[model samples]
Target: MSLVKKFATVASGTLMSRVLGFTREMLMAAALGTGPVADAFYAAFQFPNTFRRLFAEGAFNTAFVPLFAKEIEAGGIDGARRFSEEVFGVLFSVLIALTIVMELAMPLLVRTIIAPGFAGDPQKYGLTVALATIMFPYLMCMSLAAMMAGMLNSLRRYFAAAIAPVFLNVILIAVLGHAWYKGADGLSVGYAMAWGVMAAGVVQLAIVWIAARHAGISIGFKRPRLTPNVKRLLWLALPAAITGGITQINTLIGTAIASTQASAVSSLALADRVYQLPLGVVGIAVAIVLLPELSRALKAGNLVEAASLQNRSVEFTLFLTLPAAAALLAISEPIVRLLYERGEFAASGATSTVSAILAIFGLGLPAFVLIKAFTPGYFAREDTKTPMVFAAISVAVNIATALMLFPRMGAPGIAVASAIAGWVNALMLLAVLVRRGHWGHDAPLMRRIPRLVLSSALMGGALYGGAIWLAPWLASSAPVLSQATALALLCGAGALLYFVLAFATGGTDIAMIRRNIRRGQAAAASMEE
Candidate 1:
């Protein structure tokens, strides 16, 4: 499909998954509150998710997809299948070994890596270990699913892989419902949720597996071997994983520091949920499609088209991310309060604190999305190490700033540190691409970015004013309906104002968008064949 249409397709599924995830977080906030069990579970949950982000979504896909796409383009199905099977075998064995090792080292892992603070409370510490053990198996499932997703994306079949994540939220939400129905205690609920996480991974893996088969691609289990192709993949994937993994590693650092506090882990987790909506819908959709597009274009020696695709994707990234960031910066507290303040978190809630973190994330949203848009410029050309070096610098910056600020600003401090790192990472990546003569900006993109920033600023102002006007409705004792209504109106006003201002300022190019949309069918057939 056309890049825009492929983005929309992936984004639609991502939107669904993100919405479901938001619901699940709301449910979790209600069920777990800001308690010890909640803290333990979130910390433990971070373990598997960190690896999932590292191996599945981050490193593995970033490394594997471009290579896989090139193979398919150059050698066709048989060539691609042989490579995929070898990597699958190695991936499966490594994951199984990793799972077993993690299980055996559960206590030490929990004590040192996952939740050191829980060590003070035997009950909490023991439970976290148990839950992490149950969830550790999820890493194995999701890594395989991620490989399947990479294959699908390379094949231009993004819907299934994008949709697969929704089942995770669905299962977790159902588990949360069951917990409430059963009047389960905090730890009991936490345990069940952990199990639900593993179950969801299994189901996600199955769905993607079936989808891959339907797409005329299947890599069944085989005994592990170190073939030449597998060795090449490993050489590519290891560094790719590290570069892709830096963000998650930063998150791990933040969570580890947060774990030392009573309520910091839960607060950070909820804030992450709020910000991930835009990041997932906009950033991930572009990331999923951009690599293959760039890889294919560059392979055909279409340097001009490759540069254009990157520019256009970067253009869209800013277009969508600015409004999303403005809206969040404007209405974060109210949105968080409306969505999360109920059951255990009640009236006043932890919403304000989490909102602070969300706003910090807003400051960095453009940088984060731009990083995704830019990195493919490097990765598609097999230049993973440059990004990895830049990523390592970002991670060190994040860690140093996080440690310095955590003592003063708590979780919000951590968020700001990460945002700073994002800007550093993005600017450096952009500079590298420019220096290497790979990324070039067109007149339209160069002309519009400043206008986009101004439009976002205007929207932020409108949101601030609306937030003030809707103060009563957003207050603690306000009816949930009133709060929800006010938040909705506030968001609508901000979005409407952003679009009007953006267009008036010559910041947006709607005419180009329509033409791109028209080309989807032809693009789809070309990619599939």
Candidate 2:
């Protein structure tokens, strides 16, 4: 299949999950607001979720896919199967042991790493520990699922792996719905959601497991051993994990820093959700599909194809994300107010704060997506250490800047730190790629980028004026329907104008889009035969 088609499939699934995720956050805001319980719950959830992003999405997939593809080329299905089973046994056993240790060390984890700021409040600290304990087992489930997902992606079965994340949002939304029905208190909601997170993990794991079996690969338990393949995977995955989860690692640091201030963590979390829509849909989809494609091309000694794939992925990332960044900078207040300025959220006076943070996050949206596009260039070559080093540098930048700005700026400062760090990581990756002759300036992409920037700027300026014109309707005192309508119009008009500008300026054109479609169909036909 064509890269665009693969990205669309994954992005469609991600968009569904992100929409439902917004719903879950909406309900959560109403139920918990920015209270102590809310802070505790997000902290608790962030700990496990960070690992899920790090290990499942980041380390495992980056390290696993290329190697698995290599196995298939070298030894066929049977060899790949043997390799998978060997990795699974070791991964499963380590996860179980790790879960047990974490459960036992929950309090220390909560006090030290999870949220040191919570230590001042015994009730909050205890709640965080309890919630984290309940959710810690989720890491085990998702790690196993990641292994299966890597398998599916390498085998060209992208749909199941792409769709699995929806269940996390689905299960959380259902739990929130139940909580609302019962008019549950904050503490109850926290406990319920924590359990829901754990349940969702198991369901997600089962999904990929079933899909893997259906794909004609049934993996069973083998005695855990660090064979040559497993050892090699571990060696690669150790750094790849760090490199892959750069965003999450930075977020965890931000969370810890933001925890010192009241409501700061929750505020940052809300802003994160808004910006993540684009990141998940475009950035993640590109990374996932790009990795295997690049790996295959390079493995077959097709440097030209590898370079083309990298450039296209970068172009695709910016094409989608630039306007998104513009929209966020232009209409973040209305969007945040529309999504979360209801129930306890309105009363908590968090709309302005969250909106400010969202706008700052928008500043970094393109960088975040670019990181996803660039890193695959390294991972496909199995050079994980370079990105890992860059990731460390980015993390240091985030920590130093956040600490410096947060005292005066609060939540928005953390957003700034994350944005700066994202750019640092993305640029470093690109620089190293060019230095090593792995990437070069694609003439077409270079021409389109400035045009895309101009289009986004024009759209953003118009949307800014529109937001001012519609301020009355989007006001806090305005009717809910009026607020929703004004925000929708602002976004829709901005998108329409941006596309028109894009086509007119040759940032992208109908002919190019049509060619991509035809290319995708032709590729799919060849694969089928």
Models 1 onward score TM values of: 0.97, 0.99
- As for candidate 2, its clashing pairs are none
User: For every model in order, what is the number of clashing pairs?
Assistant: 2, 0
lDDT of 2 at 522: 81
TM-score of 2: 0.99
Which 10-residue span in candidate 2 carries the lowest summed lDDT?
519-528
Question: Tens digit of lDDT per residue, candidate 2, span 1-529?
Answer: 6788899988998898999989999988988888788899899999999998898889777999999999999998899999999999999999999899999999998888989999999999999999999999999999999999999999999899989999999999999999889888888989999999999999999999999999988998999999999999999998999999999999999999988898998998988998999999998889889899899889889887788888888888989999999999989999988888888887899998999999999999999899999999999889999999999999999999999999999989999999999999999999989999999778988999999999999999999999999999999899989999888888888899999999999999888878877876785687578
Which has the greatest TM-score?
Answer: 2
lDDT of 2 at 37: 87
C-alpha RMSD (angstroms) for model 1:
1.5
Q: In candidate 1, how many Å is residue 410 off?
A: 1.3
